[model samples]
Target chain A: MTASTAGTRLAIDASDLVKTYKGGVQAVRGVNLRIPAGTVFGLLGPNGAGKSTLVRMLTTLSAPTGGSASVAGFDIVRQQKQVRRAIGCVAQNSGVDVQATGRENLLLQGRVYGMRGVELNRRADELLLRFGLAEVGNRFVKTYSGGMKRKLDVALGLMHSPQVLFLDEPTTGLDPEARSEMWEQIRELAWDQGLTILLTTHYLEEADQLARNLAIVDQGRIVVEGTPDELKAQLNGDAVSLELAAGSDADTAKSIALEQGGVLSEIGVDGLTLRGRSADGAGAVPALLAALEAADIHVASVTVARPSLDDVYMRYTGRSFNAAEQAAAHAAKEEKK
Target chain B: MSALADTWYMTGRAFRAFLRQPMYVAFTLIQPMIWLLLFGQLFKSVTQLPGFGASNYETYLVPSIVVMSGFFGAGWGGMAILDDLTRGVLDRFLVSPVNRASLILGRLIVQVLSIVIQAIIILLFGAAVGASYHHLVMGVLVLMVATNLLATAIGALSYGLALLVRREESIIAASNFVLMPLQFMSTGFMALVLMPHWMQDITKFNPVNWTLVAGRGALGADPDWGPIFENLGYLAVLMVLCAWVSTRAFRSYQRSM
Candidate 1:
């Protein structure tokens, strides 16, 4: 298949990639992806959607069972050294040495990447300051907080000034505040350094905030691929939600909403609630209120908002974001067994 | 750059970590000291046996203890690999431009250096207890080379196994399983002539026995250069073979990952 070349030069290119575990379980099945330079490309997936597996292949950690991948213009298998030289990987698990001082860890990473003498020390100090880790650079990593360790992991990955950076779930277990800080750092790296970033995340808000373009992956394949705005625009309307009194007849409320030029999206049985999408939720609300009044349905509350990435994901996958995440976690556990 | 300079830089890191925990240093030396104190006295009268070469048991037993200590120390060398794997330090190195073989070689070199230091300490303790080297200077140099080679081979083998098993418990179990039998089967405790004919035949295949023979030749009153070279040759072959196998195991580990 002809790969897409719409943006800048490709930093990562994979075609028909496949990876199978030891017990004949296919972790990644015939996936293809292209990431352009100087853009943040988010790979959004439920836990076992082969996002990590794909990252591993692209980073040259593992060879694909079939098909091929190239990172920074080097074949992942045949030219693995060059691939490794060009790409930095902050893996899903924080790969920091807890016993070593944060500065020592970065220095060792620089040495391993062939940086030497004055240049290595200078770069290590630079990264420490850039990542706000200069104060803790001399402290052993075991004393570091979770966020600090994660920042160190990222710093280690970037010691060589790699062309492409693969951050696999950069904020998986962080608190809300830490997660936001991580997002901001990621954005700064992409914007300030012009580094091509491929980030994998299950958080819809994170993807929407950080990615210029994203691919929604599920069951080891790309389900949909587009910019976050483009994907949200696919819904093509504003979202309206209504909460009615108990026993107020949700069917009647949905019918009322449909008659008011809004498409009935969903209805909740317990609260007798209705949700819909429309070009103009404000204009549709009065007509819907009139219909509900004629039907004697007591509307307790109503809300209208722009279509969020959550709604877009639910619309495309027919599953709530949380439910999809739970399912993905379950699949990953089963695969591990 | 000189290879020694490269090896020293790598070895220095290991030594720094070793110095951080005095308890580990104490633990490493305690085992060899036990053999020196207890086993040396127990076999004090055994040196009266003909062709034993050494007039005193302490003199004979010290060299054996050094070789034994080196082997025992080498068995635990894989702990560094296991620790690195658990901490993701190995993966960090794998993703970099460093020489892949150097990663393993550097660690093994550090292990050998550490074992050599332990050997020197044991030798000094033996000298204090009235044990003397046969060809003083040559004996010291040969003992260092032989013990380092033996320890390096075992250490590299353990490292390769660490990559295969990828668990501390399993690596310890496998190292113990290999080490205990070799320690007993070799001439570490008793001379070859004192053992059964069957055991004597078996010692020919044991690398530990070769180390003991080489070390013993250096410490005896009448040093036999021929048997020393022969024993050194055996250990040299074992080192090459084990290193080759370990490299293969390392390659398999990378493939599996």
Candidate 2:
């Protein structure tokens, strides 16, 4: 597998990619993305947002039902093996053999890629050292800590030095310390090696911290795509949050909040809590309070904060990210019953 | 790497993993020894009956026990595939350039090796009990070859079910359903002539009987070369059929993915 030359050429170019599984579940719908070489891109979404389905299709693990995608200039459908060779995938689930030692796991992965002899051994050793797994390299992976197992998963994917790496929900289950360590490692991989990394995550903070560019996927579609700062900056103001008193109709409060001039977007409500965007949050507070009181809505508290990825998601998807997540969970629970 | 080279590498890895589980190997060997001693003592008078194949019941029982061990051991080979599947190790192999057939074949090779070892242990135990392989060296070699082919064929079927079922409880349940009935229906523990006329007719088509008849023909003072070669032919065909079924199962598994 040859690496692409340094240029503005796209490392990953996917257009209107769609995946409809058996039983008519459409996991990915009309996803379009263009990621340039040597960038850390994140596909940010809550659970069941189809982030993994898109990653699976790109990695050649699952086939898409419609549209097309190309990874490292190889067609995902016509040149599947080429795509598989060009890109490394660290799936959501850990893929390391639990009974095998960390070193043996790396060697097995390298051999599967057709690497053998002294060169394969040297590369395996180098990765163990790089991922801080050299100390326990001989121990079976079942005995490794969760963080160490995750590190080895990443190390396995990097054994062949592919041009592009796909890390699906890389930090979903890691503790804070391990998450930061993984973030540092990802930063180094992109900065030092110039590796193009496509990372998927549900953690908005993870995307904000580690990704140079990101797309917010919700319910099988990309709601918005840009750098984290740019996406948040598009809101152009502070987020005004208020806790309405009990028995207050959130819809009525929203209507009152919208009537106040300078309200930039819809008022997001989760039960008695309401939020909206405004250019001058402090200046509009008194008018908003008066309007709410006049409408018989009692305001318990109010706070103004800088826009975050959450607010950006709220702006595009028309629902608070947290609420969408809760609703999805509740739906899943109901289905289980 | 070529498919053969890949198969060899995977076979080595699988064999090492199997060796690490010393308890599993110990139990696998211990079970057959118990069966040989306990069952041999219990049925020692069966040779006195007419139409019995041999005077020494120990010699008559040795070959059947070896074939039974091979069959029983191979019936659980699917558990290995299930472990690989649930752990995502199989997916790692699937996404790579490794040969698909080699993955299934490598696990079968481990089963074949285990079957040979089990057969040797039984043979040594029979020797200690005054049961001799009059053909001696050639008898042991032929028995190993027969057990190896039988184990691999059954192993292929076991792994095929693993890929299809993809559940441990289901595989264990399915194994229990097939193994004992298969053994009793064949001439595994009794002479075909001693069985009912109907059982004798049906046992001729049973794969386990083919293995047992071939294995017993190679043992004792008068070695029957004709039936041994003929039964070996039947086992060779069964081996190819099982391998093809496993290959098709792998394809269905990929499509499901």
All DockQ scores: 0.55, 0.57
Worst 10 residues of 2 chain A by lDDT: A1-10
Indicate which candidate wins on DockQ: 2
Interface Cα RMSD, each model? 2.0, 1.5
lDDT of 2 by residue, B154-223 (tens): 8899998999989899889988998888889887667778998988888888888888878788775787
Alpha carbon lDDT of each predicted model = 0.81, 0.86
Give the lDDT of residue A17 in candidate 1.
96
- lDDT, candidate 1, B1-257, per-residue tens: 33444344455556666666788888777777878999888878777878655577777788788888888888988888888777777777677656667777777766776787888888888888887777878888888788878988998888888888888898778877888889889877676788889999999988888887787777667778998999898888888998998999878877776
Count of residue pairs whose backbone atoms collide, per candidate? 0, 0
Assess every candidate by TM-score.
Answer: 0.92, 0.90
